[model samples]
Target: MGRLIYDGEHRPIVLDDRTLAHLKVVVTTKLRRHEGFTMSWRHPDNQPRGRSTIWLHPSIPLKFIFDAPEPPELNQRWIQDLMDSANSSGGIALVDEVIDGPQ
Candidate 1:
């Protein structure tokens, strides 16, 4: 199992290679298209921080793209939506749900 660390706190969450791969597609495609959006999420077992919001945009100083593998089904409309939202002034939006998958 991989851990989701918020700011500095660590919470346990399941993260499989497939999930990481899918996430990579969702994020990178958005960045490449110049869309902007926000994602809010709370890691399971990490109630201390409550919730976290990430501004998904190319202009942001942080990058989660380099950390994941590309997904095969990255051409879905949802992917486009993510990219569009990420590119727009509104930025991409996401809600956090602790991944519960293989270790």
Candidate 2:
């Protein structure tokens, strides 16, 4: 699993490396543009039954740590979908990457 440590929080939000990789792209783009958005996701099976959400802003400190030494190839379609969501009123909803989209 990968870890996303925000604002020096004691409990880092853990996610799979692949998901974290994809999310990193979106979060980076948004923060680069000084845009902030909310990202929400359902807890994994190993965790308690619940969901978590966080607001991402450029001013906030965020770190993405991966178990894998190298970053994985990113999906452009997934990134576009995430960007679209971030532009929406509801903000980004962390969804599984859809491989059906064009390569």
The count of backbone overlaps in candidate 2 is 0
User: How well does candidate 1 match the true structure in TM-score terms?
Assistant: 0.46
User: What is the Å distance of residue 41 in model 2 from its true position?
Assistant: 0.8
- The 0-to-1 C-alpha lDDT of every candidate, in the order given, reads 0.49, 0.89
Question: Which regions of candidate 2 fall more than 4 Å away from where they truly are?
Answer: 101-103
For candidate 1, the 10 contiguous residues with the lowest summed lDDT are 1-10
Query: Evaluated with TM-score, which candidate comes out highest?
Result: 2
lDDT of 1: 0.49
Candidate 1, position 55, lDDT: 59
TM-score of every candidate: 0.46, 0.90
Error of 1 at 5 (Å): 9.5
